[model samples]
Target: MPPYPYLATDYDGAAAHAAIFMVQWKREGDSLARYLVRIGEMTESLKIIQQALEGVPGGPYEYFEMRRFEGLKDPEWNGFEYRFISKKPSPTFELSKEELYMRVEAPKGELVIFL
Candidate 1:
């Protein structure tokens, strides 16, 4: 809220404190998933940001675990990308709660735990 974004660390004091933007974005491709986080720049014509993550899909499952966060600037673009690898890849099955957690009666008249 101080007109900038700050990254906190577990060591003790804040780690990265710099002019940052509120809007961040995420992107994923065949071999790379990345995030663009604005760190500094005056306008869209002079954009500067950090590539918060750029790696294969099976890389670290946490943001902080990403190793190479590089700085990039583009005078004609505005974007941000980041990924919090979820506990599971987006469930392609897209099953509803009722489908995932259900109780069933067995053929022999027994209750089955189908959660």
Candidate 2:
């Protein structure tokens, strides 16, 4: 059996290799084997988080685009304005009459929406 089944195609290759070794050595229904795979996945996730944190650029982290709306006031500050707050009403949109379908991989399972 292939470790990391067909549906797990989006996962990292190194993790899949590690899973292959675990699957080859362990019994099919072993709880400890499952726990170890979970641990390995967590470790891989932490490594990814660390790399992302290191790559992040130094900040004035907050950015807000200055937008012009009929009822809103003009922004007071030029660069990195801290006091500006704008609340605009949501714009109306027109959708086509045709059917719309969307699918997303949720945590528990696949989620689908149809309109």
Candidate 3:
């Protein structure tokens, strides 16, 4: 499996297959290898796009949930009712004090993040 959890979400596995080819053919500081990898990745991306289009679920092009604001009255000022007002306070999130580190495969190379 790839180091990143996000890569596993590729349902058709095209990206992961392309990644494997890249790892096998990539060379250090080689422009030609980089170019080849980019081409291979593009081909795989096209395949993934085609597959997604073929498997798309048919439904309404757009949908709105009027029930979200049901029974809530907006305040009117100068004949303009403010519909964007929040009905409730937003939730807050707090992170732990411990340091965190993560790394993922990027197009150019591995990307590292520290917090």
Once fitted onto the true fold, the runs of candidate 2 whose alpha carbons sit more than 4 angstroms away are 1-29, 65-115
TM-score of each: 0.14, 0.33, 0.32
Cand. 2 Cα-lDDT: 0.47
lDDT (C-alpha, whole model) for all candidates: 0.34, 0.47, 0.48
Candidate 3 lDDT tens digits, 78-112:
12223342222212324468965555557887576
Question: Model 1 TM-score?
Answer: 0.14
Q: Candidates sorted by lDDT, descending order?
A: 3, 2, 1
Top lDDT prediction, candidate number: 3
Candidate 3 error regions (>4 Å): 1-29, 65-115
- What residue runs in model 1 are displaced by over 4 Å at the alpha carbon? 11-19, 23-50, 54-115
After TM-score superposition, the amount by which residue 88's alpha carbon in candidate 1 deviates from its true location, in angstroms, is 17
Angstrom error at residue 6, model 3: 13
lDDT of 1 by residue, 1-109 (tens): 2334544344342323332444433454423233223322234213223322221124356553233232324321222312331222221236666655333446776
Clash tally, candidates in order: 6, 0, 0
lDDT of 1: 0.34
